[model samples]
Target chain A: MLLLSACGAREVVVQGNFPKPLMDPLPLTLGVIYTDEFAQHEIFDEAAGRAESDWLVKTGDAQVEFWNTLLNGMFQEVVQIKDSQTLEAYKNTVDAVIIPAVADLQYTIPLHTNIKIYEIWMKYRFKMVSLEDVHGNENGDLSIKPDQYFADWTLTAYGKTPTAFLQSDEEAVNLAAVVALRDAGANFATSFSRVPDIAAWMAEGLQPPPAEATDIQRLEND
Target chain B: MIRVIQGKLIAGLVLAMSILQGCVNATVDEMTFLEPTEGIGDASVVIIGRRHAPDYETEFDFIECIGDHIRRGDNSISVLHELDFINMMYPWFEPRTAPLRTDDIEKLLSQERVANRFEELKLEYMIWIDGSTIETNSSGSMTCGVGPGGAGCFGFGTWGNAADYEATIWDFTDEIEVGRISANTSGQSYMPAVVVPIPIIAPVQGTACDSLGDQLLKYLSAKM
Candidate 1:
């Protein structure tokens, strides 16, 4: 019974120190909402065989920490709101609102291979709602409806143990999770502005005045 | 009779020690693209491991071993810890975001923040190590059993391991790949048991690390 019970369960609480990204912040205020489910996310996978163990991985704290550090570095101002309702309350105070959720997570173990490697894959769903209008407004305030989102995208990240030195399954999973989180942070930081909608939004802000308006100003000066 | 038994015990001890120290063969090769001109006076260098490969990753310990070897001899160059450099550079040096080519690095340095950090670190070279040690083959097995009379393990097993790694040196000052070094090591490990199992492990990865490290030391210090 003891021998059989040896493969009962493996639990891991992922933790790591996430560094602030070293990039110029975008000139926009962002309101972020971390849902309760996102802040306390965990995944459980049942054991498939007598030799395989069940895994319960808790990645809540690390997720919040990583995204917080990344967003703080990527934007000029970040406002952490309680939920969507709070975001609605602060709609006029911020340029955009972003909500992030874990879409899915998958893992692989060495039981299927000769190499002692552990890998983790994560998919994240992000909803970005632009409160400001793409075109200039009379009062320079472009508040859109709270429920409308300009961009909803998914990002995937992957991580694996670099070496076979780690023996414990829990430790391996934690390390893999941390690596995946770091990869996600890197991907988001480098590619956030490149997302088509975000790019168009930013470009709109930089657009030159209309040619007719320029000619009218020139005529007035003459 | 007593002397004979003592002699036999001494022989057994000698045989066990010999078996414990496994056999490993390692080779290192270097290719210099452009010779280094300036000395490393006050500048530092960072050794990073490539982890972007889908199948394998360069071990962190191996990179650290190479760093330790480089710093061992006289007039050692300044070496930065891989994690420290990665953390300081943040997303830029991550596995997904790291520059894969010399021109990519130049473009990264064009950024004001990256440029500032590079200048602050006084980084002159960046050595990116890529590869891994893997067990190539395994054969034979042993069985262990316990009985009322006694417990015994009887089996013979053997396995083969190989370590292959390559290091590419990028001269940040010149914004070019200056040199490359590669190491390949392989060995066979054995386990033969009668009543008690004895394992003889071949240190292939360690041998590869040492060989690669020595060559990097010689190559980098030669510039100074």
Candidate 2:
């Protein structure tokens, strides 16, 4: 007889603690995005689509909420530097036409992980644009390009020797993703530093200095 | 007395070899479904759905079950067809009404006609699979080495439209089924495998495909 588990057999678990997202990029400005043939393909499957259009009237609303959460988790941090002015000015500068040209993060390559070993991988892409054009600046040239962005994650800890299992393999993997996400953010900061609005906005929204801590304890501690 | 003891020992050895031998042990566990259901939209059209398949090794135990079932005078094909979608032919082939129909004459899942080698063998029934446990283990780009477990590089993965598409296609509640699944696996490559510990409950009312070539072969093959 094939042995079945009464409670259901668990083949794998969260072997690694996924890194907690540092923070939400604030003063959020949604990117309108660029168009590409393959990259712009529909994101929904047949069954999911049918459940909305034909069967349920409110399906579209639920569907919209779902992707929003995914997109929300993608961009976790926006640190501000004192060099940037007010949040509104930073937001306007960040929303300037060029922001949409880059893909918003769908997922980040967590730190210290070799993406190759993963059974599941995630990635995203976008149409790049320039800020000078958003406000229709005289210097705007309407530069355009497809920016394909990718990050990798690995899920291992299966079939390792019993001795290997004795260690906390799962935590190791989770920590790796956290570090990797930070690395990817740093990468974005390095590349987009040229865009003053992007640089200024990113500084203000991504990471607040210890002095600017919003925690309730900070006020009491001081 | 010694000779009798030797006979008993030989019988036990034969039984052990038959019962104990089985497939390899490789388990995949875990699935991360990324997303927000919100913006997940329906595509304008669907040309085809894609799913991967498991390989022979991990499913070796099922094959052994087939072997035992056959040894027990079971004329049944005893197939562990591709997961979730089992379709086999014996009496006559009721292939799908599609451009890419399976011609018994062809030994392939593609076009161009030719007889399959197994034409002589009795094919009782095949399990049309919708779900599967197979995955490719090789890494690197598929061009060089193995692709994703879900991708077909090492042929180690299992994901077939058999589960979703076929489940709807072969509406079990309204349609007829011969037997209920006894034991199995379900879920992602890692956590997906499920086992129904109890004996399979045969369907109360079901339709058994009657075929001349396949049923006859099933009979003859079992005898052998």
Candidate 3:
């Protein structure tokens, strides 16, 4: 049993620190929902051939940590809700809610490619919903429901590293995963306001504060 | 007698080192667009690798080697590490969002945050390095076999390695490309085995790094 377990699969827990984006914050209280699957996401792949080994990659913790830091930097205020029920309780306090999920993930190894590189590709789905009318219950507690979604969009990211730099396959995969995550964060930070739906939503009342509004010192300290 | 023995040891060590090192041929080409009028002063600079290419990513160790060489060569210049500067600027220097041209840098600087950080670092120049060391050619092979009495190997193997790198210096203070330097190096490595394999490896990448680094230091330190 021990020998079998040893040969079963190679496991890699993605680990890396993500930097906060340098940008002016939007003036809005944002609510974020992290579903269980998204928070504990993992990928298991079976060996495709004799030259390959089964892989188990866990990137959930890094994803959660990265998004948390990025969103905090992108917005004036960010609230993390426990679940859907909790989101209802905080809906009145926030302008809108965003739910992020991992839509798909794929990877390639040097053994599979002619170039000595390891690559990882990730896709993310974001659902942005607006709050409906706020109502007070008998206890004076505010209740609100999620209304029409302001935006539902998908984002794709890619990362690759050369085998010459890394000594082991696990390390290469971990680095590639981190690179892809950073890429996704960069793409989202730079293109978020450009999304048509997001643009229209922000156009209603919120215009990103001018360049002077950004806190450069604070970002540098972070 | 003791002095003679120490001298002999030192001479033997030098001979061994020379024997172990393979032959390397290096060529460097440099062009300066804007000459510096004054010393670098208290201003700092960053050397970052370009990883936007689809086929290859510049080796981080090579970039570090160049930075180390420059720092060791000059004491007045401040060299910010590649990873630190990239992280300090965050998304702006990322592989996907990094500026591709000098004009793009102007656009990036227009962003107050990026410009603020650039000023905070006292950054005067940015060196964007791109290229990689590759195994260009290989010939011969080695076969090893073990016997019950003892293990022995007999064969020969040789491979050719080449490193091609280019460094583009961008003067952030002037918001223009100052100059470009390129280093090309190649060498042949050999491994011969009688009972045990003896490998004489070529320092192709190291040669390129040293050649490029020396030229960069001269350019940065030049006052005319």
Give the Å shift of residue B203 in candidate 3.
Answer: 1.0
For residues B1-224, write the lDDT of model 2, one tens digit per residue. Answer: 99999689768655644454222322222211211123112211001111222111112222333333433443333332332111122111211111122232232322211123123222322322222232233222212143454322222222211111121111111222222122222222211112111112121111111111222223224243
For candidate 2, write residues A170-194 as lDDT tens digits: 3333333332233333333224434
Q: What is the interface RMSD of each candidate, in Å?
A: 1.0, 25.6, 0.8
Per-residue lDDT value at A95 in model 2: 38
Tens digits of per-residue lDDT for model 3, A7-35: 67899999998998898788888877676
Interface CA root-mean-square deviation for model 1? 1.0
Rank list by TM-score? 3, 1, 2
TM-score of chain A of each: 0.79, 0.25, 0.80
- lDDT by residue (A1-222, candidate 1, tens digit) is 988777788889999888999988899888776666788989999988877788899999889988999999989999886533554566677877677889999987777466567888999988775533222224432223333456678999988984355367777878899999999999898888899877876788833222221111110111
Which stretch of 10 consecutive residues in model 3 chain A shows the poorest summed lDDT? Answer: A213-222
Q: For each candidate, what TM-score against the reference?
A: 0.84, 0.20, 0.87
What is the clash tally of candidate 2?
81
How high is the TM-score of chain A in model 2?
0.25
- Cα deviation at B74, candidate 1, in Å, is 3.9
Ranking by DockQ: 3, 1, 2
DockQ of each: 0.62, 0.01, 0.65
